[model samples]
Target: MAPLMNRSFTTANTPGIVHIADSAAKRINSINAKAASNPPQAFRITVDSGGCHGYQYVMGLTKEINPAEDVVFEKDGAKVVVDKVSLDLCTGSTLEFVEELIGSSFQVVGNPKAETSCGCKISFNVN
Candidate 1:
């Protein structure tokens, strides 16, 4: 009998640490391009507790630097920085944008730390 071998997958050449939809990326890029005068110092993504599911996603453009923040991924002029506390909860996650009839929003997909998420898709529960 032959022994089974495990196969591992890696993301080495992936374009961005946070994946943006084509439409979303185009919009963000357009906005970023116009910021040449005073471009964003950095983009920050954080996880907080408050949502019905016990966790919420927060994102913003930051000018102040936090020495303790952990940089998870950056690509295509888009950078994603997560705090040490959130890093453990966001490892191996991909950021995505979704446009629907109701609205458009940025969401985290394939989060290994998430055990379940709300129907609205705005929050998650960590395992």
Candidate 2:
């Protein structure tokens, strides 16, 4: 589980919105197009505890979803899912696909609830 979000930081977002960058949506579409699953797949983001920072982001491609616990954000026929708890902690964030010298990956950027995040970008701390 991720560290609890500071309640004070949770109210800055517009509910039911999760921004997907053009690069992220394109990447999601590419991944889903190659998926063999009958239902295709969605990129899942789950925040968990234990990192240099108070919380870390765990992401993967998933074919399963728990409706009650998951929130789906879609763009350009691509899907990104996050649990309700994580949504509360990062509602105003943008999902971005970054290409770097090391590799390319999905990252959460512009999180209004994050006080500070690690240089690696996978871990964050909320004030």
Candidate 3:
């Protein structure tokens, strides 16, 4: 078995940082409004080893805060949080919300460190 290879990100100096696109912010704000309680929350993003590629992204909404573990990004009253480990793979990436005929969702775009990405756009590989 191979050890888990933890490749250091170039943006290590500024870890847990992510960029939010305008469309994403708008969508997040709308979602927050629809929440009946504990609204105006943050999107917490996580990455783990999975998918046909080496990594996958996960996200959820949260009202809780843990200063030691999360880095936050904000725009137009919307907030996003990326934990240290996930940020290593996500730093300098743009978070966008897209609406397609199939459905709509938030996605990571412009990941400079990814060598190749799956057709689904949810998985990626790095050198």
lDDT for each candidate structure: 0.61, 0.78, 0.77
User: Please, what are the lDDT tens digits per residue for candidate 3 over residues 1-127?
Assistant: 1122222122234545578888988888888888855657888888889988999888788888676776667776677888877888878788999889888889998988888999888999988
- 1 or 3, which is superior by TM-score? 3
Off by over 4 Å in 3: 1-13
Clash pairs for candidate 3 = none
TM-scores of the candidates in the order shown: 0.71, 0.83, 0.84
Worst 10 residues of 2 by lDDT: 2-11
Model 3 weakest 10-residue run by lDDT: 1-10
RMSD (CA, Å), candidate 2 to true, equals: 7.7
- Model 2 C-alpha lDDT versus the unseen true structure: 0.78
Error of 1 at 44 (Å): 1.5
Clashing pairs in 1: none
lDDT of 1: 0.61
* Total residue pair clashes for candidate 3: 0
Per-residue accuracy of model 2 over 16-107 as CA lDDT, tens digit each = 44578889988888877766466868888888887888888898989898877787777766778888887878787888999999988889
